[model samples]
Target: MGATPVQAAEDGRVNRDKLRELIGRMTLEEKVGQLFVMRVYGHSATAPDQVDIDHNLEEIGVRSAAELIAKYHVGGIIYFAWAHNTRDPHQIADLSNGIQKSGLQQTTPVPLLISTDQEHGIVCRVGKPATLMPGAMALGAGGSTSDARRAAKIAGAELAAVGIRQNYAPVADVNVNPANPVIGVRSFGADPQAVAELVAAQVKGYQSGGVAATSKHFPGHGDTATDSHTGIPYIHHTREQWQELDAPPFEAAIAAGIDSIMTAHIVVPALDAAEDPATLSPPILTGILREQLGYDGVVVTDSLGMQGVRTKYGDDRVPVLALKAGVDQLLNPPDLAVAWNAVLAAVRGGELTEARLDESILRILELKARRGLFKQPYVTHKGVDRVVGTRSHLASADRIAEATTTLLVNEGGALPLSRRRQPNLLVVGADPASPSGSTGPPTTVLAKALTELGFTATALSTGTAPTAAKIDEAVAAASGKDAVIVGTYNVAAGSAQSTLVSRLAATGVPVVTVAIRNPYDVAQLSGQKATLAAYSWTDVELRAAARVIAGKAEPEGRLPVPVQRADDPTRTLYPIGYGLSY
Candidate 1:
């Protein structure tokens, strides 16, 4: 006998008859609308009406997000930092409910797949009150798939409580290149197998917590030096090389039944000879991803507004090309109406067949159904408040942070600063302003935590990077201190901060360097008496780092990425899985 055919129900369960009925009822415009995911600002009353044209198409400006839903019928909505204007859980829930309610008011009334880039750790788009968990690298450093699963579950539950059905997270990229500016700490680790194991575990946890997990920047964006948000990154690797290095995690994601897979905006000439990005390349998206890898889930493009896609294809052509290249959904199109109309025109002109459009729409609809969004599209305010940033979740985050604090170097045994002696410590480099736009843990919090641990701690910031004069001033201030702890955020990018630490280490005083963002900072300040990797500057992680420094807690994390020595870039000082305890 043949295999039984599955069905989809109106509530988005497996009821094939209902799915066929709904798809048959959708018009061409509605089908085209299902291919685009647009962005919305805060819950402000003012409608965005500023219009401009690029490449012979008028940009779509709206008075409100409701207008976009009612008029264009977008398939989904992605929230950015702007949309999360307030940190209040109830207010954020109300915003999500409002967006979903507006979609219901539309003629077709298909529920929107509300999504956000809540990849906790360094890349949290949604601001405060959301439990700040460690990033992917931190999970890998912790060396436990169970921690990855637990952290993802907590994050997924918090997001789901706010009516978010999808999280564009658990980046599958393997950060093999230390110079990789964009994906360093975001990736789980440098080893493909390790990343695969952790990625699969996170996928299961996210799905178990009721949010659809999206394995992102598919194939991989780990080995490049460029940021896709700014420009196109080229990856030079043969097909076999890519499969061995970058394909494992994505394969694991598919095996774990991830609901969505996002396309990278980078160019891989080995995959496709064309200069076009993966987001617009048929060979990369359709041929390799669909045919070779056998990813049958909804394939989404990275933000269409990114320079990687926008610079090559204008606003008018991006959506059409993306749809033609087998993308199921266009994320953050430059102009929603223009992109929607262009797709409609493509189908009408036979440039894209109605059957082709339906293929993606069906996948998207299936995902919505699988997520049970059709059943409960809105979340209650009380539910959001109760689950989001709950005490238990925060405690989990704290434990994860502490578990991921790595002691990379402690030659002089500067750590576990003798509590009985009560060292007079001067803490520096806790910049409140994160260069990545993330609100990191404040310097005051670290100082307060240390003070509570019976140390006389003083906190100071040299902004992002301190100058020579500022370094000299800091050294003078540290003249009488028993120990100096310098917090470095993204030291890989800031040479001045590294120099300041080096100068402090040269002063012959005990200097403990804490890398607050990337673990690679240890390579620059290897001369320090002690070096620690926190991986994130969030409140929980900073407090955990302080606790480890004071011997209140032990460092348990291993290094996730290789660190090149400061004196020799060719030599790796600390390889993956290298860490120490007091």
Candidate 2:
């Protein structure tokens, strides 16, 4: 295997010799072509049958992706997982090899960069068996830098197996607001310092394992209650406040040598709200990042299709605005023609001078050279087997699944439910019949794990108000049983989903409320009953709850983010990295 990209660039320096040698050989158009990153819908060149393939080709303007890369001199491809695309991992590896072998149009022979959103551990790739590690919050709950490293390694190794070099991961946003719509479980925690440490570890793990890592949402997207994927999230912190809260993680990650930084589509009125979102803001991207933090590596934009940019800037002009603002690459351009025309027009119109374009291309080429793409042998199908997912990786994933579980609140020594004593129990789900269907996986896992323990468990789903009949049955079942488990799966945002908690609180039974998804929900019912947080929707979290509740194991996991009240207290709901173990 080749050296990790970090080591290749190690001397604490960028190699100017090799960089100049490569840049001297590229044509103006060819060099310009390498600046735009296009999204590929399918796994391989032969994927999705001929009809689907032909349509994608006609629409994108290139049949085989190899042909596209060669014809347009496109520099990179970002992969995604939609049901229509081939899901086979090996096939994806083959496709990547084809693009690499398409060769360079210029003398430098720069290999096309392959990137993907394997943020939650290779969500897109087919070769690697998936690791059900809890999301970012779980890692924050686990409060182990080692776990952060492990998650990054899991993501890095899987992506590298399929020939993907860049990973958009280790979301650096600090989840200060529990109600943050999109970045909930994706962020580290509310504290900037904790977020910095965890995110840095993740970046180190990925880079050390030979995959480049990107720390995202530049100024920070963790405090907003809105999702930028849907609309522009306006952050209200002043410059001093922003520096204190949102800027630390990016600074820490860059100091640790993370390869890429992704810009978010957030509006900061104090900064550049009138002109552009952060992704296309020269003041933020160029002035703040390039100047203040001293980030010299590639700067990538978030998906151009996001409503934040598409709604305001318009698809026809985002590429130019982003380029002039110091973005290194346009990621996931919705309309390639629009991006191409916009960029070309910028150059012709002198809005984006040739010198500026060359500067961005130079950094990209430097990254490619550092990755040893120009020197290493082109990957072939023969080596495809050697690189895809392996048995050892799957085992590592299973272990991580077990380590990231959190038990936020417990009472009645109700966890590690005793099968010998409370043999018969009523499982109150988010709804009256099935909890997993209504609220997600935490409560479902509790229900399933209890069943595995040889206890007689019946799952009842309930909404804001448990049906009169279902509540009566649950109350009747609780009368004879030793305990009643209510699965309340509420998120930080949205409605409080705990009708079972409310109903069971009214009853005299020893009620245990398992917060399957949000920590805030557990906080809401603090005075009523025993509450615990699984922090995610994965199976491992449920099993962890099973072990703790069965008295077979102790609840060792803590809260990564603070849980607060409806009135919003000065302190968070649960303090950062707070956990209780018996």
Candidate 3:
């Protein structure tokens, strides 16, 4: 009913005159609340008796999403399935509409920025009914910016259709570390230039889709080994290397007019010796991102609940310090009231001026308006089915997934398992853990795809660390099958996962290994008859992998990152851009 965010002020940009006047009318508490993007636990926005509403009550002392908004004048709400905030497409749309309804009833009536970590592949928060895209590394493996743009566009449109106007996606990290615990396959690739190209494309794609895109973990979360959710990792890259390795993607995203840039919680001594992590570092956030890269877009912090960002700072102190460091948003602090009150107190105490808070509020208000939230914030529930998970999006996802199904090793031409002969296949491996905690989607998807293609495919989920009995069962299953397909997840050379692949390879059956989660798993799985990377263990990715094995889809993807030898990091086993096709 209204213009997309990208076109709201197509030529003139946001109405600063109106936004500033509205800011002048707001109380300091309201302005401070606008900077926070809090998380509430519930499937229904206004339902107090809904599932997981206790978490909302305990966290924010609010029983409903509507209460969280009306009580705090909250500016944004991020949904997570784990928090019981999302389910099917219609439920998510209804929840979003209810949240917007509460926000629109505010004194000044600003639209809430409803968002989620819809990073598709492995990090997907919403599933099934929402169309999933082949994630960043998959797009990188395919090495097509055009496809990347289309995938994000489709995903963005789907999210927007469900009233989710903001997506925390298009991970710009150039994952260089094989052992990176957090941002491995989530990144575009190991190369800065390639990652930059895809990031720019996705930014434009999401913008074109009516949802505001947030390019994230700014200054790069690619090379670090630590998971910021657990602990703070320090990057050792020099200032020049940061510019070369980490800066290009963000630079490109900014150039593409990305609506937001989320900050990383990691410490980079190169960027600022003064600031422990990039999230609260003025030198990094203000000096580098804002001044150096010239990004005028919203600077949102990585979750304040993360151990990395909260380690050196207090719960209340994190928000204040982050604001002082030029962050426009403080995302999901563990306690909402503490963060809000601390910020409110800082302004009242003259530690943080109301004028300072206005800077962030104005930008946030502009974002809300640009997204056409001012013109139309609600969506009809009927429209959710029409756009959320359409057939065309699924086809595009499959196409992108097929493009990323890379053949890393095909010794003796073990792949293209004979469909005419009707090979009985055994799909057995650990169903990798997703960020959302669900496992076995990829393993099951692979089996289903193989079976649909006329193969007798049986799937067995060997738990992450397979027990002796589980491995024996898998080995026994492989012994009877015509061929064995093992899905290895982030395997180290002599690790139990590598041992599983080795045991499967010795089954006297033609063994095909799929690097289901990380592409680096292939380096340790050298003994397998064939090896390929699906990049991520999502439905589409593994489905594409199955099609490739069954000769239905060609392995068109190349290695996005180099796989170094297990024993020596110096030796390259498979260089970047290395992928075999028969």
Candidate 4:
């Protein structure tokens, strides 16, 4: 290793001399390894009980994650919901510590960047022990950047305490398409300006709390109807339209000095004539994101396991293509060993230059240095319990949830449902079947909260979509009730939920429809006497909705996206910023 005299600047930037010296000492294999971020679990694959069943280890040509770390010298490890299966904060901390120890045992001893998809709300990968807040759309509905900043700070602090230095969150995509299967509630709002402000605030909050905030799915994935996880969704907007709608938030993120940006797999024909997804298109990644937007931070690709990228480029080729397109880190590459060897081959074959590879490695090293990982790379088990899901953090979550409950419609003052009357309430659509396997707070939370407020509340859930028989059963049950509170989750997917609510409303019981997930459910169930948008099915949001119904807490949330009327798709029933209070 050649040592150059490079001093640390006044701004505490990474010393160029130290970065170059570290690069000088690394072999080509080690340098290639630094560009890949792999996923790991708590247990070792080579263990007697775990052998042959460890598919991840089998693909990577390593018997154990520790062995992979020592040999491959991967730059980072990402934890998904499956990785945190133990659910115990102490166990999670131990796992993180173990990984860091193994990284230190390597010849180069570069610290691994511990990361997770802790986007909070329904998308939280680490559940229970982590404080669950209403996600991005709810924060936008609350209409307070300060609250968004506070929520991010609390989330960032908890993640940092558990040794997770990077959070793939604060989704900057604008939810302009209501039929958008994936980014609906995950986005901040339909308006670009509002989304930009909140995204910037979240970036500031995350960095302030010692965790790198990632503004994700660059060039926007919000307007497309398809989910990128399943296929390549094309965004058919021109450059002028992108500037007016999608590009503003990302521009704001760069200005906020976001630590990282994750690329979407969607194709933008206007940006690149080649039919390649943004992940493999230099015109989109290097040209638009780097040159046009002037983003100097690390650019990471979304999981290569996703079909969007997998269908076009197999696991063996996606990593090299992403590197050629200027992505600094390859997140969740399909096969670590194959991707690593492929990149090594590319450099040797002159497909990729060593100088180009060094640029990404330097950026990755700078990120690790900026996070102060070299000083303290491990976290204590006690720290996890102290910071994760503390009372104060939960309180912030509750406040945001309460503030985000938007009452979109209230016919004949049906809201503030007279708790004094002790009305018999039939609660429908509380626990719908989730296709994505997301677990929310208990369905009984809303019924229990309403019951405590002097109203007799009965809860019923007929999965994601109810059959005709189920609808009849619900209507029969609601016959004698004084009021009906029907909770709808993603009614746009099918007519079953809307049909049930419309039928129940026809029974002449003051029907109060609450949008449990998608706010656009209001447009479908227009016959309901009252409509509310809870945005998420989390406990805090459910309880907040119940309180608003009982006149306990005033709803302060506004619609973050427009609701297209069911009768006419061209017409919007409720515009953005539409909300009512008690």
Give the top-scoring candidate (lDDT). Answer: 3
- In candidate 3, what are the lDDT values of residues 1-582, reduced to their tens digit? 323222233343677887887788777778988999988888888784544677777778988989998899989999888887777788888888888888767776677999889887788888876788888889999999999999989988888888888889889988988889999988989999999999999999998988889998888998888999999988999999988898999999999999999999999998898757899999999999988888887889999999999889899899999999999988999998899999999999988999998999888888887887877788877788788778988888888888999998888888888887788999888776653423345667789889999999999998668878888889988877889888888887677877887787777878898888888887776568899899878778888998999999899999989989877889999999999998
Q: Scored by Cα lDDT, where does model 4 land?
A: 0.82
Candidate 3's TM-score? 0.96
Query: What's model 1's overall lDDT?
Result: 0.81
For each of the candidates, the C-alpha root-mean-square deviation to the true structure, in angstroms, is 4.5, 4.6, 2.4, 3.2
Determine which window of 10 residues in candidate 3 has minimal summed lDDT.
1-10
For each candidate, give its TM-score against the true structure: 0.93, 0.85, 0.96, 0.94
Q: Which stretches of candidate 1 lie over 4 Å from their true place?
A: 1-12, 44-60, 84-86, 430-442, 492-494
Candidates arranged by lDDT, highest first: 3, 4, 1, 2
lDDT of 4 by residue, 416-510 (tens): 89866788988877475431123443346677889988899888776567889989999999989999888788886448887887789889998
Write model 1 residue lDDT over 1-582, tens digit each, in one string: 111122344443566566666777788888888888877665421333233111112344555567667778888888776443244567667767777777666666677888889887777766557777888988888888998999999888888887788899889999998888888888999999999999999999999888999998876899898999999999998899999999999999999999999999999999999868999999988898899989899999989988888888778899999888889989988777678888888888889999998889889988887887766677887787788877888889888888899998888577878988888988887584542233444566677789988999988776566878888888887888888888887675448887888778777778898888888887766468998898877677788999999998899999888888777889888988899988
Position 495, candidate 2: lDDT:
40
Checking candidate 1 for backbone clashes, the offending pairs are 7-14, 7-15, 7-16, 8-15, 8-16, 9-15, 12-369, 47-63
Model 2, which residues run further than 4 Å from truth? 1-15, 54-64, 83-86, 103-109, 121-128, 273-275, 377-403, 421-487, 491-496, 504-510, 526-529, 567-573
Better of 1 and 2 by lDDT: 1
Better of 3 and 4 by lDDT: 3
lDDT per model vs. reference = 0.81, 0.70, 0.86, 0.82
